[model samples]
Target: MKGLTLDAALARLLIVVLMALTLLPFLSMFSAALAPSGSYPPGLAWPADPQWANFAKAFEVAKMDELLLSSLLIVVGTVPLSVLFATMAGYGLAKFDKGRGRWFYLVFVLGLTLPFEAVITPLYYEIKALGLLNTRFAIILPLIGLYMPFGVYWMRTHFVNTPKELSEAAQIDGASEWKQFWLVHVPLARPAIMSLAILQFLWTWNQFLLPVVLVQDPLQRTMAGALGAFQGQWGTDIPLLCAGALLILAPTIAIFLIFQRQFVAALLQGAVKG
Candidate 1:
C-alpha cells in the first residue's frame, strides 16, 4: 500500500512539473507581449506598465479580421467534407475488409506513411495545373485529401471494434446498409467523430506550409501561414511580434480550452474501448 501510494505521489509530482514546463513559454510570451512595442523584454519579467493596447495594435496591423474570415472559410470548407468522407470510407472499409476493400484500406494505410513535405511539390504542381493555386480551394482540397488517411483510420478503428451484433441486429430489422450506417453506427461513433472534427479543425487552422506554398497572397493564406509575412515586416519589434503571435494563437487556444472536456472524454472512451 505504501509503495503504491509513493508511486502515485511521484506520478502526480511529475505531471505538475511537466505542466509547468509546458506553460512556462506561454507565460513568458504573454509577459513579453504586454511590454511596450519595439522594446526588447528583459528575460521573462512582466512590464511595470503593461501595454495592453499592443494586442489591439497587432490585430489591426496584421489585418487579422480578414485572416480570421479566410481561416473560417477554409475550415468550414475542409472539416465537414473531410469528416463525412472519412467516416463513410472508414465504415465501408470496416464493413467490407475483403479482396478489393482490403486493397483500398491498404492504400489508405500507405497514405499514412506519406509525409506532407514529400508530396508538397507535386501537390503544388497539381494545384497549379487545376488552376487552384492561390485560391481557397488550393488549401481546402489538399487539406481534405491529407486529413483523409488519419481520419479514416480513426473512424475505422471505432467501427471495427464496435460489436457486430449492433449491425446484425439493424440488418435483421429491415434496415439498409446506409440506414444502418447513418442511424446506428454514426450515432454511436459521435465521440470519435467529434474528436476527429476537433482535430481536423485545429490542423486546418494551423496549417502553414500548404497555405504558404499553394497560396501566394498573404491575405488568402491561413493566419499562421500569413505570420511569415507579418514577421518579416515586423521582425525588429519583439514585443509587437510576440503580441501578433499571441493573437494568431488565441483562437486555437480558446477552442481547445472550450472543447477540452469533449476531447479528453473521447480519448478516454477510445482508451477504454481499445
Candidate 2:
C-alpha cells in the first residue's frame, strides 16, 4: 500500500515538473513581451513598468486583422473539404477492406510516410504551373491533399472500431449506402470528427512554410508564416517581436483551452479502442 502511494506521489510530481517545463518558455515570452519596445528583457525577470500597450502596437504593426482574415479563408477552404473526403474514403476503406480498398488504403498509408519538406519543391513547381503560386489556393489545396492521409487514417480508426451490427441493422432497414453513412455512422462519429477538425484547425493556423514559399504578400500568408516578415522588420525590437509572436499564438491557445475536453475525450476513446 505504501509503495503504491509513493508511486502515485511521484507521478504527480513528475506531471507538475513537466507542466512547469512546458510553461516556462511561454512565461518568459510573455514577460519579454511586456517589457518596453526595443529593449532586450533580462531572462524571465518581471519588468518594473510593463508596457501593456505593446500588444496593441504589435497588432497594428503586424496587420493582424488582415492576416486573421486570410487564415480564416485558407482554413475554411481546407478543413471541411478535407474532412468530408477523408471521412468518406475512410468509411469505404473500413467497410470494404476485402478487395481494391486494401490497395487504396495502402496508397494512403504510403502517403503517411512522406514528409512535407520532401514534397515542397515539387509542390512549389506544381502550384506555379497551375498559376496558384501566389494565391490562397496554393496553401489550401496543398494542405487538403497533405492532410488526407492522416485525416483518413484517423477517421478509419474510429469507423473500424464501430460495431458492424449497427451498419448491418441499418442495411436491414432498407437504407442506401449514402443514408447508412450519413444517418448511421456520421452521428456516432461526432467526437472523432470534432477532434480531427480541431487538430486540422490548429495545423492550418500555424502553417508557415507553404505560405512563405508560395505567397509573397505578408497579408496573404498565415499569421505564423508572416512572422518571418514581421521579424525581419522588427528584429531589433525584441519586446515588440515577442509581443507579435504571442499575438500570433493567442488564437491557437484560446481554441485548445476551449475544446481541450473534447480533444481529450476523443483521444482517450481512440486509445482505449485502438
Candidate 3:
C-alpha cells in the first residue's frame, strides 16, 4: 500500500479529501447535536461537552414524535406497495417476453428519465380530482408512483440476469410460476431487493416537495415538512434545530448501520457479478 509513485500518492490524497468532504457535514451535525447546552458549539473543531439531552429536547421542542410517526408511516406504507408491484412487474417483464412490444416495457423504464416537476402539475390536479389533497395517502401514493420506474427497472435488471434454467427446472416439477418466483427467484433477488429498499426508504423518508404540495394540512405534515417549519419558527435555536436535524438523520443512520453488510455486499456484488 505504501509503494505508490508520486502521481499515485497525489491521487490518494485527492481521494481522501473528497471522502472527507462528504463526511464533514455529518460529523459536524453529530457533534453539534451532542454539544453542551446554552453555548455555541466549538464549530465542529471537536465536542467541548457532549449533551445527550438535546435529542430528547429536540423531540419535545419540535413535536417531532408526530412528524416521525408520519414519516415512518409513509415509508412503511409506500416501500411495500411499490416494491411488491415493482417486483411483479420487473419479474413479468424479464420472463414474459411475449404479449406486447418491448416498447411498452421500455416506456416503463423511460419514466425514470422524466423530471418529477414536469409531472407534478398534472399530479396535483389528479390528486384534487380524487379529493386526496392534504392527506398522507396523497403524498405517499404519488411517491410510490414516482419511485416505481426505478424499482421496477432494478428488479427487472436482476431478473434478467438470473438464468432461465432455474425457472425451467421449477416448471419441470409441479411448481407453478408463482411458486418458482417465490422459492427460487426471490432468493437470488435479495441483493437487488435490499438495494431498492435502501434507496426507496431514504428517498421516501426525506421526501419534501410532494408532501408540501399534496399535504397542506399540518396535522399530516411529515418530518421533512416539520423540519422546514421548525427552521422558520426557530431559525436561531441552533441546538434545538440541530436536534431536529439529527432526528431526521437518526433513522437513516440506524438503517445504514443495520444493513451495512447489504451495502458492502451490494458494492462487492456489483464489482463481481454482472
Candidate 4:
C-alpha cells in the first residue's frame, strides 16, 4: 500500500511538470496578445492594462472571417469524403481475401512512410498540370489523398478487432455486403469513426504546408497557411500577431477538449489490439 501510494504521487508530480512544460508557450502567447498592439512584450510578462481590442484588430486586419470560411469549406470537402472512402477501403481490407487484402494493405502502410516534403514538389507540378493551382480543389484533392494512408490504417484496426460473428450473422440474415457494412460494422465503429473525424478535422483545419504550396491565393488557403502571409504583412505588430495565432489555435483546442474522451478511448482500443 505504501509503495503504491508513493508511485502514484510520483506519477502525478511528473504529469504536473509535463503539463507546465506544454502550457508555458501558450500562456506566454496569451500574455503577449493581451499587451498593447505595436508594443513588443517581453516573454511571459503580463500587461498592466490588457488590450482587449487587440483581438478585434487581429480579426479585422487578418480577415479572419474569410480565413474561417475557407477553412470550413476545405474541412467539409475533405473529411467526409476521406472518411467514407477510408472506411470502405478499411472494411474491404479487413474482411476480404487474405492474400490480396494483405498486399493492398501493405500499399497503404507504405503511404504512411512517405513524408509531405518528399512529394510536395512532384505534387505541385501535377496539380499545375491539372490546372488546380490557386483553387480550393488544389487543397481539397491533395488532402484527401494525403489523409488516406492513416485513415485506412485507423479504420482497418477497428474493423479487424471487431468480432467477425456480427458480420457473419448479418450475412446469414440475407444482408448484402453493403448492408452488412453500413448496418453492422458501421454502428460498431461509431467510436473509431468519431475519433477519426476529429483527427481529420484537426488535421485539415490546421493544415499549413499543402494549402500554402498548392493554393496560391491567401483567401483560399487554410487559416494556418494564411498566417504565413499575415505574419509577413504584420510581423512587427507583436500583440496582433499573437492574437491571430490564438484565433487559429482556438478551434483545434476546443475540438480536442470536446471529443478528447472518444479520442483517448480509440487510441487505447488501437493500442490494446496492437
Q: Provide the overall lDDT of each model, using Cα atoms, as 2-decimal numbers.
A: 0.93, 0.93, 0.81, 0.92
lDDT of 1 by residue, 1-274 (tens): 3557887988988999999999999999999999998899987898999999999999999999999999999999999999999999999999997899889888998999999999999999999999988999999999999999988888888898989999889989999999999999999999899999998899999999999999889999999999999999999998999999999999999999999988887678667754
User: Can you give the TM-score per candidate against the true fold?
Assistant: 0.95, 0.97, 0.86, 0.97
Candidate 2 yields a Cα-based lDDT of: 0.93
Where does candidate 1 stray beyond 4 Å? 1-4, 269-274
Candidate 2, 31-128: lDDT as tens digits: 99999888989989899999999999999999999999999999999999999999999999999887898888989989999999999999999999
- Indicate the residue-level lDDT of 258 in model 4: 93
Instruction: In model 3, state the lDDT of residue 219.
Output: 47
Lowest lDDT 10-mer window, candidate 2? 1-10
Pairs clashing within candidate 3 = none
Per-residue lDDT of model 3, residues 1-274, tens digit only:
4888999999999999999999998888778778765566767756766788988987887787778788888888899888888898889888875668366578887898988889889999999999998888898888888888888777877898899889889998979988998999999898788878887887888777788777876547667766777778766767667878888778888988998888777566555643
RMSD of each: 1.9, 1.6, 2.9, 1.6
For candidate 4, list the clashing residue pairs, or say none. none
Candidate 4 — what's its lDDT?
A: 0.92
lDDT of 2 at 49: 98
Give the per-residue lDDT of model 4 (tens digit) for 81-181: 99999999999999973998999999999999999899999999999999989999999999899999999999998899889899889989999999999
